[model samples]
Every structure is written in structure tokens, then in C-alpha cells.
Target: MMPSLERASHWLALVCRLVAGIALLALLTVTIADVGTRYLHRITDGAIALRVSGSVELVSYLMLFSLLAAMAANVEKSQVVVEAFSHGLSSNLKNRLHGVYLLGFAALGLILFIGLLDSAAAAARHGEVTQDLRLPMGPIYYLAAALSLLLGLRSLIHALLSAVFGADGEVSHGE
Candidate 1:
């Protein structure tokens, strides 16, 4: 990779990780606050009432976004393999096959990107919103679509590196 491209990739990876971390933090923060406030309400006999309405909806969205944001960064690290079947395969053959597997994932990510784009458009057209939070679904789907596109791009790059340059080191899913 060129120096500039490598730097850009690092920046993108950092941003994605930050987004994923923030989403997960939001999920945990909301969960903890809800639980604590619920306990307070119980202890005070309804005097200290603090119900987190729409918490489930918010948490689900946060979780989904976190996964989407992290997808690109995690793609290279989370390799799944059936070692029993491939134990006898040569290194070159294994790398080529792994490249193909990554390509499949890339295709899947792109397909998801396209589907999410349609979902975003449909949500915008219908004025759709979350059931409990009432948050607009279009923007949410749009952001997810962007993340899925990044996932596809990242997977494609990994596939190329693996097949052409043998740049990938085998990372076991077991770890």
C-alpha cells in the first residue's frame, strides 16, 4: 500500500472504532441508568420515579449501529475456519481460498448496503420512525448503509491483499 493510503486507512479504522465504542458506551450507560433509577424508584416507594421509556428501542439501535460501525475493522480479525478440513491444504491454496471467502463476505456487505439504502429511502418516503423512541428511521438506515459500504470496501481490499500479496496473517477464530 502507498504511504498516504495506509495513513488514510488508519484514520478510517480509528473513526470506525470510535463510533463503535461510543455506541456501545451509550448502550451500557442507558442500561445502567435505567436499572439504577428503577431500583431508586422501588426503594422510594414511587416517590423517586424515573422510568426510561423507549430504552429497549434505543438499546437495540445502539447495538445495531455498533455492530455496523465495527464491521469493517473486525472483518480481517474475525476469520472462521474448519481446521479439520483444511489441515492438509498448502499455504498458497489456503490463502487463495481465504481470499475467496473474504470476497463472499464483501459481496454480502455490498448487498446489505444496497438493501439498507432502499430501506432508508422507503423510510423517508413513509415518514417511518422507531416504535418507542419515535426517532426517524431514514437517517439511521442511511448511516448503516454507509457503514456497510465501508465493510464491503474493506473486505475487498483484504481479499486483494490476501490473494495477490499474501499480506494476511492467519488469525484463528478460536482465539
Candidate 2:
């Protein structure tokens, strides 16, 4: 890889980590504020009407993004793997296994992409809305689907790099 490309990847990964952390913090803040407002309103017999509607939708979005960020880290560390067969495999066989893993990830990514489309369509048809805030659920599902797709793409890339470069800085899943 060129120096610039490697640097870009590293920067992108760092940004993803930062975004995931911020999102989690936002979720925590929202939850705490909602709870405090609700409690205060009840105690004072005030009409605060603090509702946490659509927050769950936001949670789902943030959760999936956080998951994808974690998955990206796993890919960077080469820490995601199918261990059931890997543990018994010889070094020579591990190379072949990695190739198979790549192919599997490609297929899985395609399948997940299709499923996400279907889910989005279904959500549109049903007009599913979040209970409290009436936020559409489509976006959350799409976010999760996108994360799954990215994970699959990262797996495929990892396999390609491993196959071509032969595990220079690769971190083993076992570690």
C-alpha cells in the first residue's frame, strides 16, 4: 500500500472510533436527561410531558454504528475469524481458509444487502413509526444493514490483504 493510502485508512478508522464514542455518550446523556425530567415532573405535579419517543430509534442507529466501528477495529487487528475450523488447521491450510472466508464474506454481504432492501421496503409499506416520537423505523434498520454490509466488505478486504501480503502486521483472532 502507498503511504498516503495507509495514512488515510488509519485516519478513517480513528474518525470512526471517535464518532462511535460520541454517539454512545449522546445516548447516555439523552437517557439520563429523560429520566431526570420525568422524575422531576412527576414529583412536582408539573406538565413537563417529557417523552423519550424516537430515542430508541436513535439508539438502534447509534448501536449499529458503534458495532460497525468495533467491526472495523476487528478487521484492522485481524481479530475476526471463524475459529471452529481454524484451530485445527495447519499454517498452510490457514491460507486456504482465509480465501474461503473472503468468498463467504462476499456472499454474505450480498445477501445482507438484499435483505436490507427488503426490510426498507417493508418498513415503507407498513409505515412503521416509533411509539413515542413517531419516528420512522426505516432509517435504523437501514443503518444496521449498512453496518453489516461494511463488516462484510472489511472481511473481504482483510482476506485479500492477507492473501497478497502474507500477514506482516496481522493480529491473530486468538490474541
Candidate 3:
């Protein structure tokens, strides 16, 4: 059961990473096209004024997705570690400290998840939409909330495993 869960989590993290990468690429493409179009319009004196409507809103949402998708993998990989002071600690001590740090991360992720849920509820109730695209904000908020919940769970699992099995507690997903 534990192995299965670990495998599932690993797959989830991989999917998230792929999604983040795609979102980032899409964002880059949109930004480049928008900028190039505007530049061409400027230079051409309105002859080739091909502006993408609602591009700012689209880019903002893409950025949000990219950030949310990458967060779980980042937590799982312990990529955000701050080694300012504990760099020379013993492996056991470091693992313990990392466990504690992961707990803290879980707490923060929980807070964000709750906040996103609240924001989603409010947005749904208020019929909030992007100014240009009129895209409903509630769905995006809810998706982010879900991803944040996953991140929190991942962090908590990592914390518990680290506490019980030390730094090498992490199960490789055949990667």
C-alpha cells in the first residue's frame, strides 16, 4: 500500500511538472506573439496592428497554473531548502530538521489551500470575471486550491517519512 501510494505520488508529481512546463511554454509563446504584434503595429503605423485581446488576463492565468503545478514537485523534491546554517549538520540531524521544515511547509500549504477555497467561494458568489475575457475566476481558483491541497499532502507525507526513516525515506518512482 505504501509503495502504491508512493508510486501514485510520483506520477502525480511528474504530471504536474509536465503541465508546468507546457504552461510556461504557452505563456512564452503568447507573450512573444503579443509583443511582436504590438511592435509590428507600432513600426507599421497601424498597417499590421494584430493585437491579441485579453492577452494580459490569459497570461496571468497561465502564470498561476504554472506556479501551482510546479509547487507539489518542488515540495516533494525539497528544492526550497535553506542551507544557510544547517549545511554542516549530521545526516540524522539534517533529516530531522528537514522533517520539521516539511511540516512547516505543509502548514503554509494548508493555509494557502484554505485561502484559495475561500477566494473561490467568494468569486463564485460574486460572479467575478476577467475584465477583458470575462472568464470566470472561480474555476481557476478552485483548481489552484486542489493543487495546493495536493502539495500540502505531499509535504506532510514527506515529513512523516523523513521522521521515521531519515533522509533516505523517499521512494524513487523508477525515475
Candidate 4:
């Protein structure tokens, strides 16, 4: 891979992480606000109208987008491993297992991509809206679809890179 391409990917991943972190923080803040409002209402009037508008749902979807967008960085760094048994394996076996793992994740990403896209389209067509908040679902669905598609692209790239470079351990020198 060219140096510029690698750098771009790294930058993209970093942007995704930043977006996700901000969305997550927003989600937390919303949750806290909702809780505080509810508590105050309950103490004051004994009946709390938990009237959180579409922002609540918006934050939720944005949070998911942030997570999906950052997936490539996680995979590239091997930070998403369940490595109890793999740590004990021989180098050859570990390489083979890593290949399998990468491929499996790529396949999963593809599935999620297709599914999310379809769901997004359906939401748009049907004009689906959240029940309680009456928020438009199309934007959330579309955002999720976009994020999932990006994740699939990232998984595909990582899988291809791993196949060519050999996924031996945490640190990849790149072939």
C-alpha cells in the first residue's frame, strides 16, 4: 500500500473515533438529563412527563454510527480479540486462525452492510417514525446504513491485507 493511502486510512479511522466519542458523550449527557428531569418531576409533582424529544433517539443512532465507523481501527490494532486460546497456539496455527477470524469478520460486515442498507431504504419508504418521540426514522436508518457499509469496506480491506501479510500477532509490520 502507498504511504498516503495508509495515512488516509489512519486519519479516517481517527475521525471515526472522534465522532464516536463525541456521540457517546452526548448520549451519556442526554441520559443524565432525562434521569435528572424525571427525578425532579417525580419529587415536585408525583407524575413525571419524560418528554425527551427526538434528540434522544438521534443521539442513540449517532452513537451507533460512531461505533461502527471506528471498527476498522479496532480491527487493525487487534484490539477486539478474545485471545485466551490463541495466545497458547503455535505460530503457524495462530496465523491460520487469524486468517479465519479476519475472513469471518469480513463476512459479518458484509451481512450487516446489506441488512442495514435494506432497513434504511425501507424506513425511508415507509416513513417510519419513532412512537413516543415521533422522530423521523429515515435519517437514523440512513446514518446506520452508511456506517455499516463503511465498516464492511474496512473489514474487507483488513481481511485482504491480512491474507497477503499474514496475521501472526498483535503487531503487523505489513508485507
lDDT of 1: 0.80
Q: Which of the two, 3 or 4, has more lDDT?
A: 3
What TM-score would each prediction reach against the true structure? Answer: 0.88, 0.64, 0.86, 0.74
Could you arrange the candidates by TM-score from highest to lowest?
Answer: 1, 3, 4, 2
Each prediction's total of clashing residue pairs, residues at least 3 apart in sequence or on different chains, is: 0, 1, 0, 0
Could you tell me how far off, in angstroms, the CA of residue 170 lies in candidate 4 after the best superposition?
6.6
lDDT per residue (tens digit) for residues 3-54 in model 1: 3334444566677889899999999998998899999999999999998998
Sort by lDDT, best first: what order? 3, 1, 4, 2
Tell me the alpha-carbon RMSD of every candidate: 3.9, 5.1, 2.3, 4.0
**Model 2 agreement with the true structure over 114-161: per-residue lDDT tens digits:** 798689778878998766667787876686576566656665555655
Candidate 2 residue runs with Cα over 4 Å from true position: 1-15, 39-51, 54-57, 78-110, 168-175
lDDT of predicted model 2: 0.63
Give one digit per residue, the lDDT tens place, for model 4 in 49-96. 664566567666667876786675565565345688667767666655
Q: Which candidate has the top score in TM-score?
A: 1
Best by lDDT: 3
* lDDT comparison, 1 vs 3, better candidate: 3
Poorest 10 consecutive residues of model 3 by lDDT?
162-171
Task: Tell me the tens digit of each residue's lDDT in model 3 across 54-162.
Answer: 8898899889889888987667566355687777878787776777788887898799899999999999999999789998999989988877887887787777767
